[model samples]
Each structure stands twice: as C-alpha cells, then as structure tokens.
Target: GEAAFAHKGGMHVNAVQKVVRSYEHIDPASIGNVRRVLMSDLAGRSNIVMKAQELGFKITSETPELKEILARIKQLEHEGYEFEAAEASLALVIRKILRHREPPFKIEGYHVSIRRDRAMTVCQASVKVKVDGVVEHTIAEGDGPVNALDQALRSALVKFYPQLKTVRLADYKVRILNSGAGTEARTRVLIESTDGKDDWGTVGVHDNIIEASLQALADSLEYRLMKK
Candidate 1:
C-alpha cells in the first residue's frame, strides 16, 4: 500500500521532496505510511535533503554540505554501492557527513583463515576491537568466511554492547558489478539484519568479496547501535 508512494527517479524525488502532494495523490499519513524518497545514482539534492530530514537532520537544498553529500553518493554509486535498498547505510553516510555519530567500537584488525579437505571445509576468523579504550579479541568458527567474521566480531563486541547479542543476519546477497571482469570484478554485498523487532539493510562495495561483506556487516551492526 505504502509502496505506491515510493519515489525513485531523480526528478520525481526532487518534486516530491519539494511538495509532497505534487506526486502523491493523498496524504500518506492518512494511511499510516510515509512518502519514501529513494536514493540512487539518479538522486538529486532534493533527495539528499529529504533523506537528511528523515534522519533527523535539519538540512535544505541551500546547505553547502548537500552538494558534497550528493557528490559522495554519486561517487559511491559509481563504485557499485546501491543505497536505494540500504537506507540504513545511507543514514550512516549522512551521519558521517554531519560528523555527529561516533562508532561504539573500532575494529583494530581481523584475520580469516579457511581450510579445505576432501571431507569438508572449515573457516575460522579472529577479530580484535577496541571499545571505551579497552581491547577485546575473539576467535570464532562459522559455515563460511563471512559468517566466521561476523561471529568473531560480534563475540568481541557483545561484551560491551550486550544488545548486539540479539542482532542476527536475516539475509545476505552479493552482486558482481562487472561480470565481464570475471573473478576480478568488484562485488556489492547487501546484508539484511534484524533484532526480532526491526530489520534494516546495509550495503558495501569492494573488489574483495570478504571486504565488501565485512563493510556491510559492520554497517548493519553499527546501524543497530545507533538506535540506542
């Protein structure tokens, strides 16, 4: 029902941002929904302004940072990041632009090792992170390198942010940006996470699948922490 009010194209989003009734026929709130302005390569300054406002930032087309944010969004989209389906990551980008959000923890380093045999394969990940000036290191094994990395990072962080214990990945998807590049193609990882109450999606892009997955996983957890 609310999907009817979802605006995507650069021009449409800009118009809707300026005057909601211009594109939307009815008041979205009347139906217990909101007009969503999706961010994409086609997004304009209006889309960025609407997004910032949705994230609780007072911004406008006149804001100087709006140009920088739009440029950064386009650059990242060119690099294979898709923000339309990853509003959580987009919100984080705005938070980064405002320099108002501080990470709950900082990853010091991480290492993932995989072993393959005729019988089976094993993946182990070791992660080190710092929270409030204290360091925590943990090792965990999982079904895959990405899973192992997520487990290891969560294990290291759960000590300080117990809320993370409830967060789990609901879905994971990876897309090769340039199939012609074959194995050398850049990858975009999209992760859907939930804490049994709310769900959010985050995106990452990199030439290394693992690195891209890590970026999305970090954004997923960071987005959850931002709620608190």
Candidate 2:
C-alpha cells in the first residue's frame, strides 16, 4: 500500500513513485515545459537569438548585428549587469540592434546629492542630456537619491521624447552579490517600468549602488522607446 505524507508547504504526496512514474514517460531533454528551466541562466547572445527565433522574431544566429549585440551585453555584464532577471531589456536591445535604431537621448553627465538638515532630509539630482545635437540640463528634487535622479532625467528628456511621460517606474530592487566585499561588493539593480500597455524589466550591476540603479533606469527608458 502507498502511504500518504503531508508536505511542508501544504502539499500532499501519496508516494515518490507516483511522481516519478508520472514523468517517466517524458523525455528529460525534450520536455517542452522544462525547456526554460534547462536553459542557462547566464544566457549569451546565441541563447537570446534562439529564444527569439522560437517566438518567430526575425533574427539569425549568423547575423553580424547579433555579434555586436552580444558584445555589448558582455561589456555591460562585465561591469556587473545581469540580464537573466531582465530578459525584456535584453530583447529590446536585440530588436534595436537588428533595426539599427538610433537612441532617443544621450546622457552627458549627472550629479546626485543628499543632505540632512536636523529634522529634514533632502535629495536632489541634476542631469544633462543631448537630443538631436541639442543639449538640455534639468534638476529635480525627490524623497530619495534614485527618485531625484529619475525625476531629473525625465525632466531633461521629456521635451525630446514626450512618450516618456507615459512611462512609470513600477518597481525597483537591489541585491548585493558579494556581501563579503562589504562596501566594495558588486550590487545588482533591477527596475520594472510600464507605459500603461506594456511592462518590462531592466538590470544593471556596479560597485556603486546608485550607478547600478542608474544603468537599470536608463535601460528601462531605452527599452520603452525602442519598443514604441
């Protein structure tokens, strides 16, 4: 007789044999359901291209632009960016590369400052952006450094890409990959953005948390525009 056991997570199983037999008829290598799990988490350009092709996206592994896109992903990852968690951003990048689309805006520089005055803390950010050879500088204040930076960046870019006004940051996350390195440890930043219709995630990595956040934020905006 098969004995039933209650699992820790409110799950119940009659026996391991039943579970094993259930999947026994399925080929491990050819299992469609587990294909995503079987894929490498640190997928490269080839993997991206393969995934895209599976979805009917017109791109070939042999394309020269594919190599360039992979190179760019590698360079960013070397600086601490992780794309596995932000596949949408990766897809946008591949699309832009394939279409040879121009970036909507170029960032020249940015400055963020946080100050505390007894009872109040203030955060400010200033950003410089170039669009069609014209440069714009804007400043904004927010509750935190990141928020301030986002506001400042948008203020500078809104005139050039008004579509940006429709986009909003839906979520943000940060993780330290190597806490043993303490303040110098690599930090990964993930940002989720939506423009009423679609949502996407972007990732960045850097020793500086703010820089990582900025990279993810920038990619999020770029992805939105490229998709549009």
Candidate 3:
C-alpha cells in the first residue's frame, strides 16, 4: 500500500486518501451552477443565448430572432467563420438580432490595389459606405493591403460614428482551412480590437484574404458601435 506522511512538531503523521461515494450529498442548485459554468466555456448559439439571458437580456434559444442568429452563425461557420474564437463578436450579433437594431453603416463597395515599383511596394484601399442614405467614399494607403483597407473603412465611418476613432486593431490572425486547395483554399481571419477601455474579437472566412479580413473588421467596428 502507498502512504503519504506529514511532519508536524518533529512528529511524522500518515495521511490517508478518502473517496466519496456519490454526488448525492451535494446540493442540486450548486451542481446546476457548476454545470452551467462548464457549458458556458463551450461556444455555441445556445450558450450565447443563455449568457444573454443571464445578463438580463430577454432571449431564448427557440426565439425566432435567435433562430435567425443561429442560422447566420451556421452559414458563416460553413464559410470558415470560427465563432468559438470570437465569442465577443457572436455576442454582439445576438444582441443586435434580439433588439432588432439596424447596422450603423452599409458597405456599398470596396477596392484594394497593390503596386510594386522599383522604389517600394504600395497598398491602397478605397471604400464606399452608406450612412443614413448618404454614401461616403474614402481612400487611404497602408503598409499592406489589410492595413490600407482598415484605414479606408475607418476613415469613411468615423465621420458618422466618432467613437470609431478611439477603436484600433490590436491583433490579426489568418488560418487556411483547406491548404490542399492551393490558392483557392478557404481562409479564416480573426481580428481583435480595443477601444482603450474594452476589447473584442471578430471573425471572417472566405477564399479571398481581403474579403475575410474585411468581414472581420466590419464586425469589430459594428460591435463597438453597438456597445457604445
């Protein structure tokens, strides 16, 4: 038999390991709370709804609006959006759907161009966004295509939503889901943003890197605006 010993006051003591028979002695409410805490760590639309309700938001898994949100989540996941890594963005989607809130802006179109010259490589982005039926077009240059696109989009949006100026991208990640497809492989992009007070993550998936990045970036901005 294996035994453990503890020394106290120059005396050796043997410690015995005991096993409990069952959880029957535990309070049912306490067990339920433990279960809930475990389930919340796993990401899913139902979990999102549960968390929303816990925060005093009136929503349910079976609600039509929740169903719509789930459908959208499924569609995006199928396209390569990984909500598990971007729960903050998913929460925002749930809030917007439950409240029937309109998006602050709509993207009309965007263009990203890369040029390589003898001097240096340049990336430029131009975006068209519609706010309150008025469309604003803006252009900007960045160290890379994604940076340029982000700058251009934010420039177009800051006029209507000044809060966006305080928001900045803190990190960005990209994962190729199907490398076997070569250049046509689907890609997932995760973007983390912070407003100096709070932080959040957003995700997107697409065959084109720019498209995926744009989707994530848009979600991050929308989430911040909604929270504000």
Q: Who wins the TM-score comparison?
A: 1
Cα lDDT of candidate 1 equals: 0.89
Q: Once superposed on the true structure, which residue ranges of model 3 sit more than 4 Å away at CA?
A: 1-46, 54-56, 61-64
- lDDT of each residue in 100-186, candidate 1, tens digit only: 557888889889999997888999999999999999999999999999999999999899999999999999999999999999999
What TM-score number comes out for model 2?
0.75
Query: CA shift at 41, candidate 1, in angstroms?
Result: 1.2
**Judged by TM-score relative to the true structure, which candidate is superior, 2 or 3?**
3
TM-score of 3: 0.76
Q: Which prediction has more favorable lDDT, 1 or 2?
A: 1
lDDT agreement of model 3 with the native: 0.74
Candidate 2, number of clashes:
1
Pairs of colliding residues, candidate 2: 80-205
Question: lDDT of all the models against the reference?
Answer: 0.89, 0.72, 0.74
lDDT of 3 by residue, 25-132 (tens): 343345343212111222355454654664457876567776677576666666666664586667766777777777889999999999997899999999999999
Per-residue lDDT for 141-192 in model 2, tens only? 9989999998988888889889899888899999998899988899998999
RMSD, one per candidate, in order: 2.0, 8.7, 11.2
Return the lDDT, model 2, position 99.
77
